[model samples]
Target: MTDMRAAFYDSYGDVDVLQVGELPDPRVGPGEALVEVRAAAVNPVDWKVMAGGLDPLMEVRFPAIPGWDVAGVVRAVGPDIPEVEVGDHVLAYGRKDWVQAGTFAELVSVPVRAIAHKPAELSWEEATALPLAGQTAARTLRDRLAVTDGDVVLVHNASGGVGRMGVQLARILGARTVIGTASERHHDRLRELGATPVVYGEGLADRVREIAPGGVDVVADFVGGVYDVSQAVLTEGGRYASIAEHDVPGIEDRIVWVRPDGAQLQWLADLVADDRLEVDVVRVFEELEDAGAALRANREGHGGKVVLRVSED
Candidate 1:
């Protein structure tokens, strides 16, 4: 039997429940590809699943592997998949189901529709950070909110992985001004990304008003408490999208979930190849064994993406 290393949890609990061990290699199915995972990104979902926070919402099978974003080379292609072949570099958002084997393994099998060709300009680690956050950002701005040129866009938590992607994508979508809320320290970085940085705190609304005096055309709130503030700043018919749960007056019913789309992923990959998009990975752990620690750090709000470097060769 082929052996592969993976970080798995047998029982839903804390980070301590995560175990790094050898497991039988995953087998690819028709229309799937076996990826020699070079890197896997840790999202909030990983920790939430491991700690049982999502148990009430979704049933997780035991011995679940936790991760969503991955970048790797195709090691073997299963029958009936023609989009990729062995040795093709790729980036993918693994299925949302936590019960299945995940990217935090030396190898992972993913459906063909979840992947995109890795941009030639990015390294494996950089590509690893793109799928989850990038796709979410794209879907939120382009599809959900339908932002347009001259629109004013505001993104909460502007320096984080998803927030940064939102900032950049908003600019690309031709928003007249992209205003971001972050700590005082990240203000400069946000500005460099073509966003007007405002410190998010007690008076977030006032600060945003000062920056975009007319009002916001779109608000993408990645931070939870900014929902009401986002709603307040919108021009009539302005759109508001949030990745986190928030209770915003007048717009509580507008919340939507982001679904994975491979065509969107391909468009994002093209942006990366053309240097219009940037992947920000804050740090990379060398192996799946370190996933527990990485998850812990991620929970503590480390900036950018934390990726696990998984390899068998």
Candidate 2:
């Protein structure tokens, strides 16, 4: 059996528990493709799951390799798979049915349903960063909220990885105005992305109201704990969706859990190819040994996507 170098942890803990070592090559199952990982994205959920934060919701096995977003070349294909071929550049939100083998490694087996062609315009780091955050924002604003022309959209935590993507996607979806809640340091960056940046905290609703006197037509809450403020500023019959909040009363599907959708990812990649979307990756940590630092960088709030480069493209 072949082996691959990867970052894995035997038990759930902090970043310190992660170890760079060798593991068996991932098996290519039917309808899947074997990717030689070039880069993998670092998200908050990687460390959160490492810390056992998802204990009740997801089944996590011991010696779990952490990372869900990947950009790489297809090395081989499983039986009956035709969506991708060997040597094809691809990216995927590679979350499987369970938590075990993952993308922070030399190779990962990804279901074709989660795989999309990586556009030449994107670097490995950019492609790696796009799948999860981009898909989350698209699912919330485009798919769920149905943001459209002349809509006034408000994005909470607009400076965050998902929030930044949300801001850009709202513009792509034809929103006339976007008000983003972010720290003062990220205000200018948010403005550059076509959002009116408002500092979060006290008077956040007032600031949003000042931007849109009538009310916001849609609210995308990337950061949790701002439901009251969102409710205060939303117009009557306005739509709302949250990735981090789930306690809203009377809303059955308000919380959006992003799924692996290749078609959705392909659309985002095409947008990147055409310069309609930006994959804002602020930092890239090279090699398997730097996985801990990569996770720490993501946890420290870098205001953009973080990537771990596993191999040269």
Candidate lDDT values, in order: 0.84, 0.95
- In model 1, pairs of residues that clash are none
Count of clashes in candidate 2: 0
Q: Which candidate is the best by lDDT?
A: 2
Locate the minimum summed-lDDT window of 10 residues in model 2: 244-253
What TM-score does structure 2 among the candidates reach? 0.99
Candidate 2, 1-313: lDDT as tens digits: 7999999999989999999999999889899999999999999999999999999999998789999999999999999987999999999999988898899999999999999999999999999999999999999999999999999999999999999999999999999999999989999999999999999998898888888999999999999989999999999999999998867776657999999999999999999999999989999898888999999999999699999999995
- Summarize candidate 1's per-residue lDDT along 125-218 as a digit string, tens digits: 8888888888888888888888889999999888888899999999999999999988888877778788999888888889889988889999
The CA lDDT at 89 in model 2 is: 98
Model 1 spans with C-alpha error above 4 angstroms? 96-98, 246-253
Model 1 Cα shift for residue 157 (angstroms)? 1.4
lDDT of 2: 0.95
Deviation of model 1 at 18, angstroms: 1.0
